[model samples]
Target chain A: MSAKEYRFRLFVAGNEPNSRLAEQNLRALCQEYLPDRYDIEVVDVLTDFEAALDSNVMIAPTVVMEAPRSVTLFGTLANKAAVISALAL
Target chain B: MVENQLPNIRKCHTRIEGLDQILQGGLPTGRTTLMIGGPGSGKSLFGLEFLYRSALAGEPGIFISFEERADSLKNNAATLGWQLAPMEQAGKLFLLEGRIDPRAVITGDFGIQSFFAILDHKLKAMGAKRVVIDALDVLMRLINDSRREQDELVALHQWLAERDVTALLTVKAPREGQLERNYDFLDYLADCVIQLDNRMLGQLSTRRLRVVKYRGSGFGSNEYPFVIGSPGITLLPISEVGLSHQALGDRVSTGLTALDDLIGGGFRRASSVLITGGTGTGKTTLCSVMAQMACARNEKVLYISFEESEAALVSAMRSSGTDLSSTLALGQLRLLSAMPEAMGAEQHLVRTLVLIKQMQPSFVIIESASACKRMGTEQAAFEYLMRLINTCKEMGITVVTTNQTAGLHNLDEISGIGISSLIDTVIQLRLLEENAFLRRKLLVMKSRGSSHSHSVHDFAITDQGVVILQKAD
Candidate 1:
């Protein structure tokens, strides 16, 4: 809404199938929707366990839309319609 | 029952000093203990302390919280002087935050298998011997259905038992008779059940803990008062045990020579002496005289004054030609001045015990008993006084107290809860009407283990503090 770049953070547990799938799905969704207007950051909870607490992520493979309004999606983020509608992408 | 011949049962020391004593050494090991209490009743504090202390004792622990986040849990523990973050990093303790919002929980035929698996992983990863599940009610509510709740609870208890880890689960209790459905189920599932209560009588609040059930073990089945204070929770099991103090034979002086002669010599060492009198009858003066004599013998005397300040008492004694300041300066006398309305009866008892243990005084004088009457109800004041006397007698400390009667006419009145029998010696002071003038007289009412003169002598307050005009005839 403010013409600022969109920021996304994906929390994963180090190379698990669901973690990799969530990362891949979020990147594809971001590329198709925002293209060059969004930035994606991947955090491995297995290395920085305290980061999970900082981000308020209870489940692994969680996608957080940190910009305008802040939304959380749990699971593999493969449902593009649900993710887009929930995040207002 | 004989103490030496008791059966041997394995127990994991709770690491809480007084609580372990109340539990008869410790809680039964490898069993689930359900701690139920209302809000602010210290359930979380107790559970956290158990895990923290066990971890400090060389046993790893896991704290699985379903109510608070790991960061908030760390902050709360920090307030109690427990450095939980370092322990978490050192692998000695593991904190798992598994809190789920109630509205977001979809309860369609779901169970707690996944949650149990998570706990299992964490426990196995750390090799923790102690585990705490704080606020199990949150997870219980997530189960929604009753059958799943029961199955999950039973399985969780069994899982902890199988791994031989002592688990503590905290649950919130409902108001008086409105027991929750899950609470009833968990009560039966846990091997031991402890109930913590915070009760408000009028304006003061008291925390108490009771063990409702302890399987295959013997414990003090009485409600013990606990305070969540500086270090952690401390339980005061006052009346759980019987009295076992040894009596002494040596006698100590009462300071006044004529009064001593009337009481057959002096007071028995380690005996509780009570002085009861009406206003203006010089009861406190007599106690001051006895305290002076004890200090003169180069013995430490602890004088607890509720009605007067130390400076006022010292000035008054100085005016009576008694040099109390010298004894105070020589470290033979310590004066503690406190108002009865300032603290509750339990606080007074704990403070008195702490001072007695630290000072090791030979004589303890509570200046006026009427002030203690204002602390609480008559029963509370009586119990506190009894415990004080019992503790002092156990350590061979001479106890003396002064009480106020109703009037000058009723010389036989034993005021302030009527604890005449609890005392070893009772002296009654009264103002007798004589020739349009009032004269103070002292009478020996009861003296245990010794015969005393029954005659009354004129008691007077002069420059020498307390002076007996006539000898016992």
Candidate 2:
């Protein structure tokens, strides 16, 4: 079987400090865990506000892991170990 | 032009009629107003009403409910005849779901930045000025620490002011014995703080809202009785009625000749008359005689009976030889009957006030004002009667209220009666316990302006109406 693909959606306010940090942290965590086998979609709520709202993302630095089981994480994901534990990677 | 005006705390109108009067213009503009109350105290309703009204008044509003769903808020608003969905669809109002799934474990540290981020975007896009956050404590749950909760409220207050948004936050007051969880910090954080109470008066609940604190504005400090009725939440600002409402009324008869002689040659028109007595003291009969006499003079009379039905009142008065059928038929007398327990004190007052406005009666007879205690509490009844009397005097309508004193209480006590100052003339009726024979006596306890007899006289309710017997003769 092909390696299980990891899909994730990150909602953020446009170019906010925490939003930028959350994006970098999430990408770093995913690259180290499931390198070349994960998908990350960054949605800037300022431009496409409804997309974040549609996913029920009320916080800026929120990550929704859709593949290998769905999980939601809040904040900038500064604690990469916690994010890794949350994604079960 | 608006900016050219001197900067001050601009009042945002709640759109509630009397609420604005007591609020001295409405809530302090663009400042967080903290509404704290126990459950069912009408806190959420008040917040929702403020937004609904501002939206309809051409200013947009956004309602962020953290605990209740937007659909549920819409359904509740519909009961108030507020078409919230249409307003929402028109972009005049918006209901944002502020709830987060409780089961979702927060594995990392988080802040409420995204909520504000979304709100900041929506506020400008909708051009909304009013923002109501219902169940603010639920949102505060995000800040697990009490100190952090306080900090968040401070941040929220500053943010709202910077955006010039009038924010109303409804927080569930700590329940009894949970004083440690009090939101005293909210009082200091917000520019205004209001407390709502749904007090249990006997078996019924009567709601009262008080402005606990207003930073740079004057508000009615006394608790204002409010009702969640049609249209929306309406507060009875009885304190707003100044003493200047005193009417320069003329003299009017009290139906009985000798009784009028005792009460300073009759009661003053547009003045309030209070009758205090125990059961079977001929108070209702005396009121009937006055009602009949008013109708005899071609003046309209509105007789509000709390205990007796309209037909019962008519028949009872007929037995006392005061036939109200002709006057009632002629529209000179309108008889309204309702049990005080049927509604809250606010409703009883509001319904009667509406009738008084529609009828424009010269005399309003509210039988057994003490019965109003059944509507709520002693304080509620006192406020109700005070507001009614003030309204009557303001409209030049004479008012007669009866207080049914219990047999155990002394006549001087005037059971459940506290509005003695508002009363122009106070008549006391008592049953003289003489040799097992109950003899009724009428005494004019107080007459504001007129001077007359100070002696008590025996009275009888005979077939020819109430007769003040000449005990001296």
Candidate 3:
């Protein structure tokens, strides 16, 4: 809905299974869905916990999207259908 | 009964009134304590009090609430006159509202790793030694999977154990709706488990606390009654004071010379006295005279009038020609009158306890026990008087209580409360018919360790005061 590029920030606890899978799946989903129109920043809470805390991240693999509208979602992001609808992809 | 704590476990004093005594010293330092209770059972308040007190004691603390907002917790603490903002401002405390968003879409798996990461950062930033995770079940319910809940609980336990921070996790006890998945693992994980109960005894509401299990530590397992008064929570064990009573002290006058002579010299100082009589048998008049005489001795007296108002008692004393103005002005006497039905039984008991603690009076005169029965059941009145008399005796304060009976025929019954054994002296008053006129009589029924007169003495309510006719017809 927006003419600007989609901005996505994902919060994760370093190298956890769901965190790793979520990172891989989000990049894959982005490459497939909106190749050059998105920006991705991954925060490993193990190192940069202040960012997680400031963003009110409660769990690992929490994705905050500032795209068409601002929203936050969390989990492994394996259910691509729910993520697409939630992120308005 | 008090237990000696083993030296292996160090205690972090909760500083809750009377709770440290129940926990021996306090909860085990650096160990998890699981609090299980139903809704409105005061688990959150307990956790809040612990954190507030910890901060006050120079031990930094943190609170993570999964079910309630931090603002609400602050509001609750504010009710108890605790300022959490200042504590937070000083970096002595941290409050995190960790309630998960209800609309969040879950795709795959989630765990406590992120939560611990943030909590670790916050704990390190504040250097908190105590932590409270309220409504841990709320977080668990979000995970939904029983296996995940178990692993996550174990992860929490190990995390707390490895760190120096002591933690208390509040869990809502599962009720009838749940057929499976009880948190038996909590007992295996936590070093201590405290249970709280909120029950109603007929018309009276009562709250209680009990320590279910305390590993490697001495604890009081008995359920102790508690009241949530102004200071948050006060656990009344009905003990501590009752356990340290000395023998009665020297003699004190009962105001009337004839009455004094009848009970040997007089009522013993620090002794408990009970006066039983019918409606028109002058129980209140006796209390008034005793209160006035005690004050006349320059002793501080506390008069609790349950049957009459303060103004009514003052007026009655004035009508009887015994002026209490000097004693009242000099602060030698304090007259407090509350209607028997004004407060709950527990409230009445706590208020009386508070009054006694504040006034530290040498004498306490309860106008009548029957009116106190109106506060609650007969058993409640019994406990009320029993605690009052026991506490007074322990503090070496002389207590005089009156109980109104049905009539003159039941003089032997000692009215309704049946605490005769606790009374050091018992005085009986009765009405008699002589010469086609009603006559008042007084008898020293029983005085322990003192020889008392068995003969019934004729007494008259003179305009001046009660006069025991020693040799009159």
Candidate 4:
């Protein structure tokens, strides 16, 4: 059987402490579990304000998993257990 | 060209008949008003109606939503039977969903300027005469400092004023205080200030609206009960009638001819009749008879049920030998069932007003208002019912309401009996044990507008309906 590929988008307004912590936490998990078949997109609202607003992002450190069928937004990326359970990694 | 000059601008019409009289011809044209209320006090819907009416008057309007999404707002408006989508499609109304980061301002990337730019663009493009910024509470979060937030609201008000656009800025009242602090700023800047309050009375939640201040115009300061429904918000203006205004009429049959003879005739028109009895004393059945009788006379009737469903009520009435199906089918009878826990008593009053407006019913019955006491404070429920009854009397509608008495022996434990004093007529139905058999008796305690029989009439409910036996001579 072929391996599954997971695509994730991490939305952060800027390089704040909360955003950095979220990034560090997600990167460590992804590197250890699915190193070869994952794509990560880090979006900064400062540079792409319109994009953030278009996505209806109300809270910061939001993680979005864009599947073919649906898109899921996890409000805070700090909750490691929720992040892992949501991504199904 | 001499006759083409702009005519003297009149006040914006609220479209609600009595409210225009209170505001001395409605709110000022091309001016902003601030509506402040606690959460769920219906500030958003109030703002929407202003904008909706503006569109109806051929003036385009814009709704800037800070809390709800565009679709949700549209759906909510639809529930009230107001079709906002058509107005949106016709370019008569515009809805803008705005989001501002509370933390963004602290980091200095975005401030109120971003909001101002969007507002300016939308207003110009739509040439909107009315704008509603629903709940400025969320927008306040964008400014970390309270002082800066106040400054932003003042500047925004001034900017809207400069544009000569009438705006409605809604705000949520602070939890502890009766009013929000930001309201002080908005009140100072606004041309008018309206406050909406929802209070718990016994088991009912009552909603009241008051004109805190209307600059340069005389307005009613009393808190008026308003309802939200199909035609939108309506304020019931209670009339103060003197005791000498009471009239005497024939006792109309409570549908039971024997009962009518028992009370000398029946219930009088335009009288406040209270049917108080213990549970299963057939109070609702008696109310249905009165409602059906009024409907048969081609008089409109409104039945506000606090207990039974419309179907159940119809079945009950049908079983009682009253052909309510035809009345309901002909639009002569309107049944409004309200869950005691779902809404407060004030909401019930407002709903009654909405029904009255839609049907213009002459006879009104609220089945078991005692059920309403379970929703809120007793005092509040009493006040709301008193106000509603007062309004009904002013409209010349005959009103009858059922209240559940706790114990057959304990008349003092009667729920909502305080309202009985205000009634033009009071009917007490009791389950009595006489000669080792349980029987039902109905007594007319008082009839303000007419002379009623003093004797108690025995009655029973069978599959055929209410059977009234002769009075104990």
Which candidate leads in DockQ?
A: 3
Tens digits of lDDT, candidate 1, B1-473? 21244566577777774788777777677888899999889888887788888878768888878887778877778887998877777888888777764434131133343355456667777887788888988777755677878888888888888999888899988888885888878888887899999886435677789999877677788988776655677777867667766686588789877888888898888888888887878877777788889988888999998889999998877777677888898878999889877766776777777778889999999867767777766665776687888888888889998888877434235745666656888888889888897888888888888899788888778885778887334
- Candidate 1 is scored at a TM of 0.82
CA deviation > 4 Å runs, candidate 3: A1-9, A24-42, A64-72, A81-89, B1-7, B177-182, B240-242, B339-344, B408-412, B433-436, B471-473
Q: What is candidate 2's CA lDDT for residue B66?
A: 83
Candidate 3 chain B, which ten residues in sequence have the lowest lDDT sum? Answer: B407-416
lDDT string, candidate 2, B1-473, tens digits: 12223346688888875777777778878788898988778877787888778778788998888888777777888888988877888898888887776754454445666677778888989998899988988878765778777777777888898999999999988878776353887877788898889876666777888889877777788888777877677777866667666564878788887887776678888888888888888888889889988988889999998889999988988998989999999999998899888887788887888788789999999887778877767776777787888888888888898888876645435635567767778888889877798888877777888896888788888897777887532
- Candidates, DockQ: 0.14, 0.37, 0.63, 0.05
- Model 1 chain B: ten consecutive residues of lowest lDDT: B102-111
lDDT measured at residue B178 in model 2 versus the true structure, 0 to 100? 79
Better of 1 and 2 by lDDT: 2
Native-referenced Cα lDDT, model 1: 0.77
Error of 2 at A22 (Å): 5.0
Best by the lDDT measure: 3
> What lDDT tens digits, residue by residue, belong to model 3 across residues B103-158?
77777887677789889888888888799999999888878888888899988899
Q: How far out, in Å, is residue B42 in model 1?
A: 1.6
TM-score for all models, in order of appearance: 0.82, 0.81, 0.91, 0.69
